[model samples]
Target: MLLLLSVCLIAQPATCRDEQIPVGGGAANAFVCLRNSQSVLAQWQDEHPEWHVEKWRCAANAAPPKKP
Candidate 1:
């Protein structure tokens, strides 16, 4: 019966069938594929109060931020 026992041991059930790709501490890899809609793009003429500031928008109902 050693052959049967060996086969049983070798056929142990697997926990998952997904291909594991290590990303940010187990967090899945994701990216946003959206166009950057804006009014215009050009060089700023003068430095103003808000000139040094940067802005970012994630659609109002954007998904939660993924792990870093």
Candidate 2:
């Protein structure tokens, strides 16, 4: 029971892809959901000024981003 609880505590939270809005003739960019914590998306936009990032929310059945 203790091990199971520990596993649950350390488990990664479910998330969905937060894709950037594409401009005219431009490709959309995908971002990982950091459990919607740390304002990571905002940070990414700040770091990459060229990309147009859109605000996104996670749904109940959202799947986490695939690892590269």
Candidate 3:
């Protein structure tokens, strides 16, 4: 489990992606992508209990950006 977690990396784009989501073609429900990160975080945690992805918003493969 740890190995799997270490290999998979998930992160938002540098600029981030935002879009307006409409339910039933803008008839019933409304959705926003401003902070959809929480959902992704929850999924990672549930998928990998052996690893603590919840601690960081990124997967284990996330290494610190190299210095110039």
Best-matching candidate per TM-score: 3
Expressed as tens digits, the lDDT of each residue in 1-68 for candidate 3 is 01111222344223222221121222221122214445554565677544443122221223342211
Query: Judged by lDDT relative to the true structure, which candidate is superior, 1 or 3?
Result: 3
Per-model clash counts, in order, read: 0, 0, 0
Tens-digit per-residue lDDT, 1-68, candidate 2: 00000011113333223343212221122223323323544565576555443334422222343221
Model 2 alpha-carbon miss at residue 55, Å: 4.1
Per-candidate RMSD, Å:
24.7, 15.2, 13.8
Judged by TM-score relative to the true structure, which candidate is superior, 1 or 2? 2
Off by over 4 Å in 1: 1-33, 38-50, 61-68
Off by over 4 Å in 2: 1-38, 59-68
Decoy 3 TM-score against native: 0.31
Looking at model 2, residue 48 earns an lDDT score of: 54
Off by over 4 Å in 3: 1-34, 54-68
Give each model's whole-structure lDDT. 0.21, 0.30, 0.30
Worst 10 residues of 1 by lDDT: 1-10
